[model samples]
Target: MWLWITGIICFIVAVRVIYNRRSGVCTSKKLLDGKTAIVTGSSAGIGKETASDLARRGARVILACRNVQKAQKVADDITGTTGNGQIFVKQLDTSDLASVRKFAKEIIDTEKELHILVNNAGIVAPSVKTLTSDGLELTMATNHFGHFLLTNMLLDLLKKSAPSGVVNVSSDGHFFGKNLVVDDLNYEKRPYPSTFACFGQTKLPNVLFTVELAERMEGTGVTTNSLHSGAVNTEIFFKTNKITDYMFGFLFKLMAKDEALGAQTTIHLAVSEDVENISGEYFADCKIAKRSEQAKDRGLAKKLWEMSEMAVSLTQEDHHYAGK
Candidate 1:
């Protein structure tokens, strides 16, 4: 009887510990009244919450998403809730190179200044290998290459808006992806790994891209960083396997954060004055965090940048703008 009572007490304590734990929050009070910010994949999940938070802080927030209708609805909701009518929706499909270029061109043509860019868009690798029309692996294209091209294309504006920031939402899962062969990034000459492994591979590039871009952007006042949002109950898991979705949903609800909590690190990286000069770093839970060894490889980072440029068919003009 005493043993049973002890077990019950311990169970209650464990439950409380799990439920009461919270992720770090961005405590910055900086207002972005005149700032123009773009958040890709802002239609839902962490991206939506991140965009909403920026809008609430008075930024003219643009929802860069693939689904125009869904993004518009999100923009409306953000405007209604925040009373910041500056929220706008623009179409962007990060998996498609053409769509990335189109979105970048429009932003450059219209927006006079860009203060923040949140490369929060990402997708799960399918169980089977998939390829984009551009002949790159679909997962790599969307999660890394597309953002790579977009950021480079907008390099001039980000630089012009001195002290600007580029926040890449990466993941700790990158540690498992050191096997990423930069030479054959698209898996064209190699065997396709499992979905999770492929997903991990894509995440590593996000950090590598941040490291490389930050180095290239030295003296430009455009800080670039990457982060791992704590596990959250997001829809990225539901779009893949039906059988596993239910299990994942249950597990996530019990162990994961809500979207708002998951957005904290991203928010911190974007608007906080604390990290205004901190670039080429990885973060988690609103604080600087250590990255994987592979993520620290400057050689790999440089190689990946060159290959990504070629894969995206970055023009001489685009290269000039980035180097300028």
Candidate 2:
């Protein structure tokens, strides 16, 4: 009987933590009045919440989404709620080079300075080896390379904004993907672990991108950071869990926070005045956490940057990917 009581008490405590939430250590105050933000994948999940938060704080949010109808709906919702600001929906398919170029040209043509670039758009499908029309792995191409190209294309506007920032929404997935057999980057030669490795390899690229971009952006005042949004109950895995969707169960609930909790870290990195000067840091649960040794490897970071640039068709000839 005593053991049963103790178990119930522990269960209650765990539930509180899993659903735990706060306004963050940094003030929830609006300090982003004059900022302009571009948030990719703003139709749902953390991205949507982050856009809303930024909008409420007085930032003009450009919703870069792949689905035109969904983007319009999200824009309508945000516009209705945050009347003090505007939400511009821009169609962007990060996997398609043509789409990426079109979006970049849109920003370029508009001549509006982008102060915040949230690389929040990403896809995590099952173990199948898929490739973009550009012939790049689906995960790496969308998650890292797409953001890389977008940043490079918008580099001038960001620089003009002066005190700009870039937030890469990474995963707590690098530890499981060290020294990934590059020869089989597509996981075709040997069957890779379906769920884990598929996402893990792309996450590794995120860390390297952060490190290399930070080094190159030393004097740009354009702080860059990646984050592991602490396991959240977002739609990121809705496609993978048919049983969960069917049953509407909460088995992973104890380990999952809601989308709001996940968006907290992203908002912090994007607009908080506390870390205005802080850059090249990895965050977890809204706090700076130590990263894996692989994340700190400058050499690895540089190599990954070079390969990614090539994959995305972005090079120094345009915007000096490597700081001169």
Candidate 3:
């Protein structure tokens, strides 16, 4: 019995070693000396690591997060660790359209040029169905709609700063969202089964949005791409119930990648010269990765774009910024 237990432990250790080795690492030494970047939800987790990587590359990074105090703390830490004091903290709650608009306006007014926009802010859906002030489902609103509006609002700036990139942090879990109803994005007609259900549903839009935006901005020099950073042990799970928190904590330590590894694909997309001309593609492990058939459906992407615009109540003025 003891021999069997020892063998099992050895196998688990070997598998973990192999898994971590397979995770991608961004080896680029590219510098972002004059570039500026905004990473939403940067106070912690994958977002925080991504922000730190950008700062280390000499980019002026804005930590756009809902918690100003927490974000400031992160900014200070990045500055101290990277010796890049250009890190700034801005308040942004992606679940709230008002907060999104407010943050976008401040960025446009103060920043002369914008080079990277990482839509990394996200939250796990509550076990119970919930709606935001905008009357949109909480998870969809934060993970998708808010980002939709923010990206369109900042499109002009990104264009003016030619050779810019938008790196959206999507997930492999999008595969579970094959049954997403484009018309019922807010889950009005559909039942919200579980937190996992809502999470997968929202990730689909991240890829679809990238596909459509890439086509729209083809010649504008503003590239858009989405990526799935393999599952990492991040703080997102702590927001769930105690049971889930404990469960994921144990599982993540056993199987998930660390935060720095999780941020590699995002860092690569933001700084890699190889993909300078690449757009509208999904990526994993620092390479162009295949997405689900639905993610590649241009017609569906276009339809979702139109629906999202209306859902966010985007105005004619906002449309002016979106690449026509």
lDDT of 3 by residue, 66-162 (tens): 9999999999999999999899999999999999999999988999999999999998778888899989999999999999999999998999998
Off by over 4 Å in 1: 1-22, 320-324
Clashing pairs in 1: none
Model 2 segments more than 4 A misplaced: 1-13, 16-28, 181-184, 187-192, 241-250, 253-255, 315-317, 320-324
| Residue-level lDDT tens digits of model 2 in 82-121 | 8854789999988787788889888988957889999998
Order of quality (TM-score): 3, 1, 2
Instruction: Report model 3's TM-score to 2 decimal places.
Output: 0.96
List the candidates' TM-scores in order. Answer: 0.94, 0.89, 0.96
Report lDDT per candidate: 0.90, 0.78, 0.90
> What TM value does model 2 have?
0.89
For model 1, what is the alpha-carbon lDDT of residue 190?
Answer: 92
RMSD of each: 2.7, 3.1, 1.5
Tell how far residue 39 is off in model 2, in angstroms: 0.5
Q: Residue 89: error of model 3 in Å?
A: 0.1
Worst 10 residues of 1 by lDDT: 315-324
Report the C-alpha lDDT of model 1 over 1-324, residue by residue, as the tens digit.
Answer: 999999887875676457437578899999999999999999999999999999999999999999999999999999999999999999999999999999999999999999999999999888778889998899999999999999999988998998899999999989878788998988989999977788889999999999999989988899999999977878888877756655776667666788988899999999998999999999998898988999999999999998898899999778624352
